[model samples]
Structure formats: structure tokens, C-alpha cells
Target: MTERHHILSDNAAALSDDAYDSDGFLIEEDGDDTSRPRLYDGDQLEREERAALRRVAGLSTELEDVTEVEYRQLRLERVVLASVWSEGTLEDAENSLRELAALAETAGALVLEGVVQRRQKPDTATYLGKGKAEELRDIVIAEGADTVICDTELAPSQRRALEDVVKVKVIDRTALILDIFAQHAKSREGKAQVELAQLQYLLPRLRGWGESMSRQAGGQAAGGQGMGSRGPGETKIELDRRRINSRIAKLRRDISGMKTHRETKRGSRRANAIPSVAIAGYTNAGKSSLLNRLTGAGVLVQNQLFATLDPTVRRSETPEGREFTLADTVGFVRQLPHQLVEAFRSTLEEVADSDLLLHVVDGSHPDPEGQISAVRAVLADVDAADVKEVIVVNKADIADPEVLDRIRRHEKHSIAVSARTGEGIEELRQLIAEELPQPDIDVDVLVPYDRGDLVSRLHEEGEVLASEHVGNGTRVTAKVNADLAAELAAYRA
Candidate 1:
């Protein structure tokens, strides 16, 4: 058997059972049953509902005898993480496995154990070598683990080979992430995009065995099967693939339509010259918390990865009363599935089109720099690399001072802030105001009293330097966009 090892502390292996109720809502544990009912908004209620339905442990129904062409659901329970250290240091491999553990937990699985193999490269036939694979099987059996999650994306053949040896279901990082997205996606577009990515990932990996997968249909071969089974037909796998393809096509169309609606809203914002700032970073890096801190958006804030899959856009104002929209986007991760990037291209475009990006980083993480690199890689994939960035080192209240100093020193336009404790938030706000796009055209306009809407627009869409009321109308001097400048041309003073 593989040597017994604790990938994480015992506390990290399982979440505190008392922290949440059976419905997944946080309940004060003062041992009082007579407390008032906690009030939750719609979003919070939906999130709690999703959490309540999370997969239970030891409930996975995957058959042990089925090795080939098994249809696996992400009903992960009692999982063992496996990784091969090819290039990075041993610490890096451990960190990767730890992250995998967090991911499994986020997907509602209990992490039993983890193992890392020091290989120059992953084995071709099996992810781990033959001996190591057997050892892993032994570990799984000993720990009663039903799933083995590889740290890297596994090819179909490799996954099959690994499962055959391990005698249990095996999945990769990509599928695990996809499953989390599947569970957390709430919006229609978000759900559709996630389904599209899942189908894309599943198409190439579809496999089958035995005559049941065969298309052959005749009197003897059918074994007294009815007339419907007598004709030359496509295999079961083929039918499933075709259905998935059809669903994918329809999802694409639906997502396309939704994309157009999103673009129209964006176009309206552009027309109004409202600046947009997208909060983006690695998963669980406090992007949503920061959004709430800045805008009181009250988005779902959980200590789990990929908790916020649907992008939330909220209108916010800078300290100077200049209005801009802040978008909380889907968090990026290392090796973010390309299928997801393609599927969520429309949503990611919000980042690409933003006036600025608040790249939040977890200052407490051991490998913050690595997380930054991974996020940037995905940003490049979405063509958002060129957008202006303000590195916001979050969790400063609990972060290592040396790590915070290192990050601030390395990033030119970085600020350290704590979303939880409200530390350095004012400085972050000021930094954002400075980094956002500024209106260039200076306008001095005298508007009629009947055109008060113009005055409000001036205050909402541009920086009003000065304003005064005259007998004829209200006179204002401000900097505005070209579009708004044209609207004020007739009233120029």
C-alpha cells in the first residue's frame, strides 16, 4: 500500500459540520433554538438551495466492475488527489494537490488522502507508473475512496487505463472544475454556457463496450428484438453523441442570442460613456467580496472556489461621484478548461471591453505569484490582456507581511486591501478612480430649465467641474465624452 500521508491537515479534510445548517445557511451556534429566522435575499436563498442539494458522501452508485466506457457523473465522494511533479519543485506539487483537494471539497466531496509522484513526466499509458498506479489502488481501497482526481487533464485513454487499475472512477482537473461550474451556475446564460463546455469535454471522451454499443440489428443478432431493432442503426454511443451535439448546437444558438442582449446593454453603457471596471482574478481570491465592499452589491460570498460563475454587473460611483459599472466576473484558474473559455467568450468580453481591471490576488496564498501567472494566462486567452489593470492584494488583514510587500513591490500599480476588515479600501477606491478612463472634452453649457434631464446626465455620466443656476437655465462646466459633448453643443456657453 502507498504510505499513509496527510495532504492537508485533518481540519481541512472536512468542513466544520456545525458551521452551516442542513440547508447550507450559516446559523449562529449559540445553542439557541428560539432565535429569529434569518432573512436571506433571493440570491442568497438560491445559493443556499444549491448548497443543500450537494452530493452526499458514500452515495456514489458507480459499479466497481465497470471499467470500460463508463458514464461518470461528478458524484465525487471520498476522493484521493494524485499529481505528477514533472517540472516544478516538490512544494509546487504539494500545493497543486492541495488545490485539488479544495476543488473536490468545493464539489461536495470528502477528501480522504492525496499523493504526488516525482516523475520526469506523466506516464503515457497510465498517469502514474504501473507500480504507482497499483499503490494508488491500494491507498484508495484502504481509505474507502470512491474517486481519484488527477491534477492535470487526462486523455481519454489515460483516464480509462487509470480507472481500470484503480478499480474506481477517475477524473481530471478540467472535469472537476466543469462540475463545479455546473452546480453553481444560476443564470440561464450561465447554465447554457456551462452545459456547452461540458458537452464539448464529453464528446471526445465518450466510450462504450459490448454488443449494446453495436449498431448491428437483425433477427438472430437482435435476440428476438422487436421490429424497431431490426434495421441498420447507429450505435448507442453514436446516438448519445448525436444528441449531445444537437444540444450543443442549440445551446450555442441560445447563448448567441443571450450574447446579443448582453452586447446591447454594453453598447448602451458605451453610448452613455459609462466606464466599466471588471473585478477578475483566480478562484476564491475575494473578487466577489471586494465587489460587495466597494459597491454593496451583496453578491454571494463563499469561501469556496468558483462560487460565482455568473457575472454580476452593478452600477457604482467613484468617490468623486462619477458613475461606472463594476462587473464581478467568473474567476480564472490554472489550466482553465479551453472549452469554458470558448463557451463563455461573450461573458469574458466584459473584461476585454472594460475601462480597467481590478486584478485581485490572495495575499495569504503561498503561491500568489503563480496564481497571478495563471490568471493572466486565461486573460490572454480571452483577449483581456491589454486592459489596464490594478493589482489589488486582498486579505491583507490576514496576509503575510513579506508576501504582501513582495507583491506590491513587483506590481507597479498594486494596492493591498482587506475585503473582510475594510483595510486600505479607501486607498483602493482612490486608485481605481485614478486608473479609470477620464473624460477629455471640456464643455460649458447653459441648459433650459425644462432640460433638467441634461443636468442629471451631466452629473451621472461625466465629471462636473462647476454648476450654477441662472435666470435662463442651469449653467454647467464639465468634462464629458464626445457623444455627450455633441448633445451639449447646442447649449454651449
Candidate 2:
């Protein structure tokens, strides 16, 4: 306990029987050049991480009887991942373990070890069985870990009781996910959403900042402040919660204003009677790449999750020379946080107002069908499932033929294409032109040449079956959508 206390902070050194550096600074690592290929080991670190470990070996207390895991997990807060396989089979347990590993990685936590208990249902007080929870605490102590990452969201009371017993930080799946988002989000809107989720998570986790609250920041409180109070107006954790909430509100307002801007733009397109097509899919499914292929949009192409948060709208002409708006939306993810779905609702509403949905899938992914299911879940959450969709089996170049065949066989509205190689793009464009709603009738008339605006509008916004020119007037024939057909009623061309 004295060693554990020192490892955490200064005031608690007498609990465990080991020595520590008491140095406050963390050894820095280079984050530049994000293009390096990641080498993940289930156990043991890569050479670089091993070198770093050697450097810090003498700086921190060493524990005996620890096993190394395969992953470039270094300088990570050690954590125990616990899960209850309720209604979960062996496969489910393995999958839960894998996902927990990913979550722990994402949260900058090293997986010291993992444990799964089977139960018909979760225990009310201790997510795992009461005895098992005690065993887990012992595991944490043996591994010298100070945190536990649970596989499910724990109720408030359950969280408190478990932390009290475990005497370690315990964060659930949702909270861990939120923390990763907090770390990954770069854009203003993304930050706002992440902070909102974090604050909401903290609001419940704030019962007490756990044992750390008992220690003062630098030394004893100079005045009459309580142990948790430190020397500030509010404790560090409380101030963090308050700051997050304030930032969340500010972000909500900003997102609202941005939403209005989107509405205004939508209204402009609506008034002009120009139809829109929105591209959406699971993260890393090549939505951005498809947008670039379809419209030469020049959207950033990255091989990472949640890379593009800002919506990019570009114009493209169909094979029939008909122009329409193509919009690229943020990618969806498995178990996407509700706060994000809510925060980006306006951006996603672009899908709701679309003329059609280009639902792209990475036919190459091992679980393309599972990705589809995850995406559909999010779409249903936002009430956009009924939108007309064209299934685009993207990444055909690297995808297995069997995988492509499986999707084609299982889904009705599917097309296989390599967005990078331009394979099947022309057919896709022509198909898009055909799937678009047609005008009720083709209007034929001659108009004054001075109304070039009307002539161009007819050409761009409507399908022109024919067009000719006469003295001081232009003769034209075209088919237009219902809305544009109405707006062009006076033009009659």
C-alpha cells in the first residue's frame, strides 16, 4: 500500500513497501510522422518500445511475476479489463476481449491482463460475481495496476462500491470510449461532442475522485480547506467537470449555428430545385475516396477512423450532362457514442434530405456484413433507414472476390467498384442518373436569348431532351424534376 501510494502521488507513499522516483514528469515520445506502419504484438514491445522500457526500468518500481503482452503498449496506465459473458458464448468472450484490448489501446492504457466470468446475468453490485471482483482486485495488485477498464457501463452505485473495494480507478466501456474520443477529436465540433460525452460521463463518476482526492496537490492545504478541496475554489476533478460542461454548452450553440447555416444552404438548393446525393458508410469504408472518384472532390483520404468530420459538398455532372450536388458525410462506427450522433445530427441530416444514399462498403474488410449491420444501427438511431440507397461495394481492387460475391448475393442494390482505379465509376454515374426521379413531362418552347440564366438553369438543373437557337431567341426542350418543373413553369422550356 505504501508503494502504491507513492506510485500514485506524494501523500500516500507509506501504504506499499517499495521505492519510487517521485518524479512528476513523463518521458516524452515523438508523435510526428504519423505514417509509420504500426507493429502490434499481442505480447512484448517492438525494439523502440523495448529501448524506452530499458531507459525507464530504473526510474519506476519493478514488479515480479508480470507477463508481457503483444502490442506496442508503452508508457500506458496499467489496467485490468473485466467482463461478464452474460448470454455470451466462447466466441463472444473472445470478441469482447479483442474489443476491450482495442478500447484499452485507444485510451492509452496497457492491458496488464484480462478476465471474463460467465453468468446468466450481471451481478447487481459488482459487475462480476462478488468473489470474482475480489479476485480481480488481487490480480490488479499482483500486476501493480492502478486502473480497471470494464466491458460494460456500470451503474453509479455499482461503480462506487467496486472502486471502494478494488481501491483502483474503474472506468466502463462508455467512459473509456469517451476518453479516447476526447483524445482523438481535433475539430471544434468533434471536441465539443467528445467533451459533452466526457462531462456527462464525469457527472456520474464524480461520487468522489476516489482515493486520489484525499491527497493535496503540492502540500497540505494552507488554510481551512478540506482534504479534497486542496487550495482551489473547486477540486481539480470538479473544475474539470465544470469546464467540460461549459465547453459542451458552447459547442452545442456553435453546432446549432452551423446547423442553421447548413439549413440555409439546403434551402438555397431546395429553392433552385437541385437534387442532392449523400455518401455515408462505416468508418474506413472509402466514403471519402468514393466521393473523390465520383466528383473529383479532393477530400482528404486517410486510413484512419473518424478522419473527416467536416462535410464536403461538390458538384458533378452525370453521363447525361445533368448536374447534381454530391455531399460527403462523417463516417459511422460500431457502438458510436450517442452524444456524437446527437452532436452531429445536423450534419447527418444531410443524409435525410438527400436525393439518394450512396451506402459505401469496404468489400475487403473481413466482416463487411458486420460493418453493414453496425452502420444500419446508426442509421436507424437517426431515423434514416428508409432512405433510398445504392449499395457501393468499394475497394474492389484489394477486396477478395468471394467477399464481393457474398455481398452481391446477400444485398440487392449492390455494385462492386474500385474507387482508386476508376473501375465501374462510369456505370455508377449512369446508374445514378437513371435512379434520379424524372420530370413529369418534357416542356418545349422558344425563349429570348437574353434569358441565358434560364437557359443555363434548364441545362444544368433539368434534363434537356433537345435545344436549338433562333433569331433573338433560344429554342429548347427538357425534362425537369417536380420542384424545378414548377419553378420553371413560367419558362416553359
Q: Which one wins on TM-score?
A: 1
Each candidate's number of clashing pairs is 0, 13
**lDDT digits (tens) for residues 1-493 of candidate 2:** 1222111112211112222233522222235833333334434323332211000011122334255432333466887777776553445454655566666765567666666655556779977656667877887898889898777888888887788789999888777767766676776766766666666666756655564543335335444454665443456577666776787788778878877888999999878777788899987799999999888778889775656777889988788777789999888766677767786788789898898889999888757887788888888877788888889999999999999998999998889999989998988998888877666667776778777887888787777878888785888888766665665577654
TM-score of each: 0.83, 0.72
Best by lDDT: 1
Evaluate residue 100 in candidate 1 and report its C-alpha lDDT on the 0 to 100 scale: 79
Q: What C-alpha RMSD separates each model from the true structure?
A: 15.7, 15.3
User: If candidate 2 were superposed on the true structure by all CA atoms, what would the RMSD be?
Assistant: 15.3
TM-score (C-alpha) between model 1 and the true structure:
0.83
In lDDT terms, how accurate is model 1? 0.84
User: Worst 10-residue stretch by lDDT in candidate 2?
Assistant: 50-59
Stretches off by above 4 angstroms in model 1 are 1-76, 226-231
